[model samples]
Every structure is written in C-alpha cells, then in structure tokens.
Target: MNGMKIQITAELLDGLVLAILKQDDYYGYALTQRVQSVIDISESTMYPVLRRLKKNGDLTTYDQPFQGRNRRYYQLTAAGEQRLQEILRLWEQYKDNLDQIFYQRGEQQ
Candidate 1:
C-alpha cells in the first residue's frame, strides 16, 4: 500500500531475491534494502521469500557477529547462483527487446 504499486507476484519476489544474491551476500536488512531499490516491496513482503529460498535450498545462511549483534547473513548456494545468472541473462534479453520496442534508445546499463 506504500511505495510503488507494481504487480509483483510471488515468483517475481523470488527472482528479486535471487538477483540481489547474485551480486553479494547480505543480512536480512541489507537484502531488504537492496530488493527495495529494485521493486518497492516492504520488509514484510520480502522476508518470506528469503525464508522460502532457504527452505527450498536455493540459499544458505550463516550467523555472523557484526556491530555487537549476531545477524543472519544470506548467500546463494551454487545452485542459487546459477539460477541468478540464468535469470539475469534472460532479463538482459528482455530489456533489450523492450528497449527496441520503446525505440527511444540512447543506451541502458
């Protein structure tokens, strides 16, 4: 109900988490922030995706002590990383096609 109202289904949220995991390992808050940068979903909506990824063995977590707190850090497993790479390649392809359709091309990175 807040932020941008994009039609994000469950699968898309999973994809978003996988996207961030591709870039770097992150704690819950950090992952939440990173995903928010891409899609305006809130922490509540995002946490379950992380949990589901860990549940489905696409992600792994370790507890690390930092800043006087023990935080659970999320990282992609080999399978998860592979999935990210595959999805990224597909996304790049989609964007390319979309740009051509929009036809106001300068360049996008």
Candidate 2:
C-alpha cells in the first residue's frame, strides 16, 4: 500500500458509501472512518458525499441519542439498494476490462 494512491471518483465514492451502509447504519464519523479504512479520505470529503446521497433520496438519516447529543446515523433507502446493485455490476465489468489489459501483460512476465 506504500506509495500507491488510487483515484476515487464521485461515482466510486457514492458506491463505497452505499456499500458500507448496506452492511449497517453508521454515524458520519464512523462512516468516514470506515471509508478511510479502505481509502484515504477526510471527513470534509465524506460529509459532502453524505449530503449528496441524502439529497438524491438514496440515503436517509435518523437521530439517535448517544453519550450526550443526538448522533445522526445514515441508512440506505430502497433506491440506494438498487443503485448499489447497479454500481456493483458496473464495477465488476470495469474490473474485468482492466484486468484483461493489466493482467494479460503480467502473464508474459
């Protein structure tokens, strides 16, 4: 993972957020951390993504009383689930295409 930076597009970020939320609900910080676990991103970056997803009706939020204040948790809507499926399918195809080019060359070595 050293010196390797993978570019994250808006579509990829949306797909990652949706995929993470599909596993379970998470607060903004936790969600940001979860994404950071896989890819390097800041809370600043994630908050906008969350807002966009919610604005698009792909995600919904609920407030939960935790510690002292209300913690906002994000969950996927039905539309989000549909989007996840579509993104996953597209990602698989994209990966296959990339592999055909990248991996084929590796085979010769």
Candidate 3:
C-alpha cells in the first residue's frame, strides 16, 4: 500500500474535521496536522474545507492569545453536531453495506 493514493471526498473531509472539533477546539495548523495524521492531505486542501464549513454555519472560530500572538481556533457549532450525527449515521450504513458485500462474497466463495 506504500505510495498508494486514497481519494478522500469532501463529505468525508467535512465529517472528519467536525468529528475532531467535537473532541476539542484546534487552531488551523493543529487541525490540519491532526487530519493529516489520519489521512494524507495538505494544508492547502484543509483551509478551504475549514472555510466552507465555517461559511455553512457548521463551525465557528475564536482567537486566543498565545505567546503574544493570537491563535485562531475552530470549534463545532450546534449545527455542526447535527451534521456530524448525520454523517456518522451515513458512514455506518455505508460501511455496513460494504462489509456485507465483502464478507458475504468471501463466505459464498
């Protein structure tokens, strides 16, 4: 699987970001790092997603002074929570469907 590229859709990206924020607020860099730890994505790809989520009212931001500089943190809004729940439900259904196909096919073979 080395060097294999996995394409992550925008819906999944949004869900991942929202899920992370659900745990705690994070600055842009930290958020991008956290997401990259799980999925291969560049900061350039992440910022626009953050902007879209914020624009959609699914997230909010705040600036906290850190070492004389303000660190902007992204937090999940109530709407974000709802959206996360919807995403999770859909993910579960999708996973289950794939699992059934994969496992059942193997068992039949």
Candidate 4:
C-alpha cells in the first residue's frame, strides 16, 4: 500500500509532542522515536521543535540518571496541555472542512 506524504507543520508537531508527553515524559531520542512511529521526521528537525516548545514555556525538562548518564526528559506543562487542546480543536475544524470538500468531490465520481 502507498501513502500520501504530507508536510508536518509546526503546529502539528507541537500538538503531537504535547499529546505524547501527556501520556508520559520522554527524552529527546525517545520522543523522536515515538513520533517516527507515525510520521517521518529527522532528529535535527525534532530538536528545534522541542527547544522551541520549552522556550515558549509549553514544556518543561528534567534530567534523570540513566545508564550512568543524565537524560533530559520533557514533560508537558499546564500551558502545554492547554495549547494541545486548542490545537486539537483547530485541527478538527480544519480536517472537517477539508473532508467536506474532498468527500463531496469523491461522491460526485
């Protein structure tokens, strides 16, 4: 089966990251892996997003000892959760609008 490749916008990335963190905290590498399971994204691409979210106060990070090294884990802050909800709402509306147009066109075929 083939899939249509779509661009992952900043809002989409931010929403996905927040949703993942809502389930549980994750380190940079682990978060990238989780996201990769669903969409294709490079490590370099993910790092800047994580940094921006943290800088925006939407996410918080803590270092934990693991395998004799400190791994930074990202958790969703209250603001992050709120932002996720807002993004989700907007995404739903956008998807609905597109679906209406696409589904109507498909039905005409």
Predicted model with the maximum TM-score? 2
Q: Between 2 and 3, whose lDDT is larger?
A: 3
Candidate 4 C-alpha lDDT tens digits along 1-109: 1488888889999999999999999999999999999888899999999999999999999999999999999999999999999999999999988897978743554
How would you encode candidate 1's per-residue C-alpha lDDT over 41-84 as one tens digit per residue? 88898788888889888899999999998999999898887777
Pairs with steric clashes in candidate 2: none
Q: What is the TM-score of each candidate against the true structure?
A: 0.73, 0.93, 0.91, 0.92
What's the lDDT of the predicted structure labeled candidate 1? 0.82
**Which rank order by lDDT, best down to worst?**
3, 4, 2, 1
**What's the lDDT for candidate 2?**
0.94
Q: Clash number for every model?
A: 0, 0, 0, 0
Please tell me which model should have the higher lDDT, number 1 or number 2.
Answer: 2
Highest lDDT: give the candidate number: 3
Better of 1 and 2 by TM-score: 2
lDDT of 4: 0.94
Name model 3 segments beyond 4 Å from true. Answer: 1-3, 105-109
Off by over 4 Å in 2: 105-109
Q: In candidate 2, what are the lDDT values of residues 1-109, reduced to their tens digit?
A: 4698989889999999999999999999999999999998888999999999999999999999999999999999999999999999999988988997977843554
Query: Whose lDDT is higher: candidate 1's or candidate 3's?
Result: 3
